[model samples]
Target: MIKPTEKPTVTLVGMDGDMLGTLRCVEKALSLAGADSEYLLKYQNEIIKDDLYKDYNRLLDVTRKYVNVRRLSREKDEEEREKARQQRRGERAGEDYKESGFES
Candidate 1:
């Protein structure tokens, strides 16, 4: 049994036992099995909307995680840039002081 977290694709089984059209069926099955109905509904609004809802929430969570990772990367880049800027300023200051006849 695929967990609700799996985001498994739903496929309709035909009368001949062959697969029919896919319909986000997993979420619907979960809903029919008495999973979170309202949350699923709020997440999606189609047939087997609940199944789609579960997939939607899962996707949102993955997106949030990626966003956090990107934010951290930006912060690291800023820190590196600042460090380089500070080093350049120090080098310029040292040159100026040396040219002012200051002792080594």
Candidate 2:
């Protein structure tokens, strides 16, 4: 439910459960990030290289409702996992999942 934001954090949280919603949310986020469509396209071609844009299909995964396709990348995946591990070991006391950057 936490739509991805334009903050300078590692993850962009604006993905909706569905493609259409996700697109809209991502567009809004990009807009808020102060990027126009053309700028974003250029950035995608430059900053956001192909490695971070991997396409993953999860149509058979019943647990997922809002999303089926996702971007799979090893770097971000490991970083988030490590953060989660640290949180489990009690990094930030009384912090919620979102506050601890665990919501995806």
Candidate 3:
């Protein structure tokens, strides 16, 4: 899995610093665009038919594995965060129960 530090830091830009779209990588963008060829063609023609798209495509080719790794890493991080949060909640509940002084 791609570490947070290892993820690519590229962002697609337009004329005068206007943001076009945020791309994780080429494969990610294509996946998001969906499996329909018509849709893919339209997207290429409408949104990515420019020098920026060319650069994104090149980057995607090089970083496809890195993108997948990053995705897995992110999912793992989220799961860990959730487990920690749940543990904290359980501990808080235990403390509350003790403070309530409900004898068995």
- Please give the CA lDDT of all the candidate structures: 0.44, 0.43, 0.46
- Tens digits of per-residue lDDT, candidate 3, 1-104, equal 12333333333322222223334243345555343445345434544555445564443443444333122245566676789899999999999998999946
**After superposition on all CA atoms, how large is the RMSD of candidate 3?**
14.0
- lDDT per residue for candidate 2 within 1-104, as digits (tens), equals 23223332123233323433444444455556565677445534532354323331222131122223344356777787888898876844546655877767
Task: Name the lDDT of candidate 2.
Answer: 0.43
On lDDT, who's better, 1 or 3?
3
Ranking by lDDT: 3, 1, 2
Global CA lDDT of candidate 1, please?
0.44
List where candidate 3 sits over 4 angstroms from the true fold.
1-72
- Per model, how many backbone clashes are there? 1, 4, 1
The best candidate by lDDT is: 3
- Residue 15 shift from truth in candidate 3, angstroms: 30
Pairwise TM-score winner, candidates 2 and 3: 3
